[model samples]
Target: MSTTNKLLAGAAILVAAYAGSSWYVGKKAEAEINHQVNEINAAIATQLALSLGEGEIKLNVVDYDRGWFSSKVNYEIRIKSAKDEQFQFLAQDHLRHGPFPFAAIAKGHIAPLLAYSDAKLLPTKETQPLFDAAKGEEPLRAHSFISFGGATKTVIDLAAIDYRDEDGNQVLMAKSEGQVDYVRKGGKEQADFTMTFPSLSLVVDEGDLHVQLNGMRANGSITEQDKAQASEGELHIDQLGINVENSTQIFIENIKTASSYEVKDGLLDSTLTYDFGKILADKQDLGQMQLDVGVKRLDYVMLNQLSQVDDLDSMDEDELLPMIKQILVNKPEVYINNFMLSNPAGSSTLTSDVRFATTALDPVENEELDLGHYVESLNADIRLSRQMIKGYFSGENMISSMADMFFNSAAEEAQEAGLVEYDGNEAKLALSFDAATNKLLLNNKPISVEELVQILFSMQMGGGLF
Candidate 1:
């Protein structure tokens, strides 16, 4: 054959091979879709059981039309809430079989893959309102790149919304987008995702109310480990503003939250932190505040079973009390690692640690619950800066005046009762409890339980003054 003919022949052979592989990949993609549906259903069942029949969810592949190099799939999702309210959603997917799908190649994705899918939520009678809110656009759209190695990278987009009513009420939402990368192997799964929303606003002309939130972002990761799940996440908002009648305005800046959960030695540990960077009311600075709280040594097994209880309200008290006792006997610890507020004047701080006893209790023998028997030890400290308190309550506002008076009265009463110790620039309270010695101390001064209870009761009755 001539050189030109030989080149054409080689090209034809390559095309044929590509065509064959594309068909094979299309078939495999269809099978994988079915397998994933089964997995989803299994997960829904497990969740339902664990939530004690809180809700029901099921996903079904209603149709799959497989072509030589592409396929169209339809899916239906049914959800029944704990309140028995039912909702149905439909999704349509266009899958291009790959080894080198045309769409992927167009995007310069050359590596081999099983398929690329473009999916969109379809409108139904129940979802018409959602569609209308999106100005007739689909509420959600997602694109997925599926790899032969059972991993998927997906990009999801949520449509922006602009809605108004005859009553002069309006709501506007900016488009939100997210990406998820997920993989499951050998009975373990991992997923990471990040999402962003530019802004959301609601306005009520009649009430002169306007609420605006801007620059919201969230990122998270979940991983399965040894039949357990560990996860961590953070959420942040650049600013949140609320204005009422142009007179009362509250603004919060850089609101952030972080949380984590993990398992260690068959026990669960978790921590959560919140930071409100700057809070302002009517343009007056209200300082910044943060809280960090954590729990350790939680009996994962007992808690897991407790979570799976079919129905708590209907369960016999005889059976439920013991389960709770068993959980408390595991000696879990709770910590308020840091609770702080800072401003130009000064700072206030509070910290606490409480632990439960490991000793088991017989509910049958002890008809009435005594918290002292289960509380192993407790330690808490509070330091209030006098300057900070004065600065915070010095605003020329009715609310501030009331708060100032209340704080002054409470401080005087507490100091007189020897519950709070005052230093040069701060007021301090240190409380500790020991179950072994049945001792309670306030400001390093021993106090009887009865006396402490009476003081607390007095505070409660006398408008929260000690």
Candidate 2:
């Protein structure tokens, strides 16, 4: 054959192969739509239950149109909260089947995928306000590429909002975007995502109230381990400010939060930390603060069941007692690993760890609960800088003066009574309790439970200290 003819034949063969594979993928994609929707619903429900305690989400396919190369699917999403409040929304998805979807190719994403989908929220009576806020643009849009290996990478965009009410109330949001990579295999699902929001503002003319947040970003990931789920995330804001007419104006800078949850061996552990780099109120600098807290060895099953309860308030003591006992049987530990605040004046720090005891009392045998017996141990340390305390209450206001006086009197009395140890510049308090030994110590000095209770009661009754 001539060279030109040979090249033409080769090109034709390649085109034929691509067309055949694309058609097959389109058929496969159509067949899997319902199954995928079910999977998505299950995942959403699980996530909602974990995060919100009690909620359900479902996605139902309303229409599907299949073609040789692409398909259109419409879905209705329904959400029900723990309060039984329901929200419904509609979305439309356009899917282009692979191996070489034209859209993906045009975007320079040519590695061969099962399909690529573009989905957008459709405006409805309930969502019309959101659409109007976005100036008639779709409030939410997502583009997803589904790999042949059952994984997906999706990019989500949130439209910028500029909304104002006749009453002079206004809300504005900058355009935000996020990406998610998700995969499910071997009966387990994993996902990673990141999101960024440049700014948000809320204003009300009634009180001259205004709140703003800027440079907010968050990233998170969730993975299944041994049939259980573990997740972690961090959120950071460059600055947050609030102002009201004739009221204190508050501003916080470089605020961050990190949290994690995990389950292992039928027990759950979680931790949360918050850090504030700078805080200012009414032009007064409050310095910085950090807090870290966590819980460990909680009965995962019991907690999960408790989280699923939609009406805890309706449950009587008789019904709730057993569930509480089940959770206590695991002997969970709660701790405040660090609570610190600092300024140029000085700093204060506190740490505490407390654990619950596994009780042998049965709900049937013991109708009345004795919470003291359920405490395994307690240990805490507190260190306060005298300078810091003084500086905090140094303002020339009636409240500050009264607070300073109260603290001075209390500190002197407490030190004299040996409940608090005062160093040159710092005051320290250490408390420990052991249930097995039936012992309680304050500042390393043994104190009977009765005496401690009496001391606290006396302090509350306006006594200096005991």
Best by TM-score: 2
Estimate every model's Cα lDDT from 0 to 1: 0.82, 0.83
| Residues 1-466, model 1: lDDT tens digits | 9999999999999999988999999999998788767755754564444334666688999999999889999999998776678999999999999988888778778889999999999989877777889987778999888899768898999999887878999888999999988798888877788999999999998559999999999998877667676778899999999999989999999999998887656677888999999989888788999999998877666666665564668879888877767767668899999999987778899999999875546433555544466678999999987667666765656765676566666777777667787655677899999887888898899987678777877767766554
CA lDDT of 365 in candidate 2?
Answer: 47
- What clash pairs does model 2 have? none
C-alpha TM-scores of all predictions: 0.84, 0.88
Worst 10 residues of 2 by lDDT: 362-371
lDDT of 2 by residue, 102-136 (tens): 89888779898889999999988778888999997
Model 2: CA > 4 A from native: 1-19, 27-52, 183-188, 360-372, 393-402, 436-438, 462-466
Q: Model 1 segments beyond 4 Å from truth?
A: 1-16, 30-53, 56-60, 165-169, 184-188, 204-208, 263-266, 299-316, 358-372, 397-406, 434-439, 445-448, 454-466
* Cand. 1 TM to true fold: 0.84
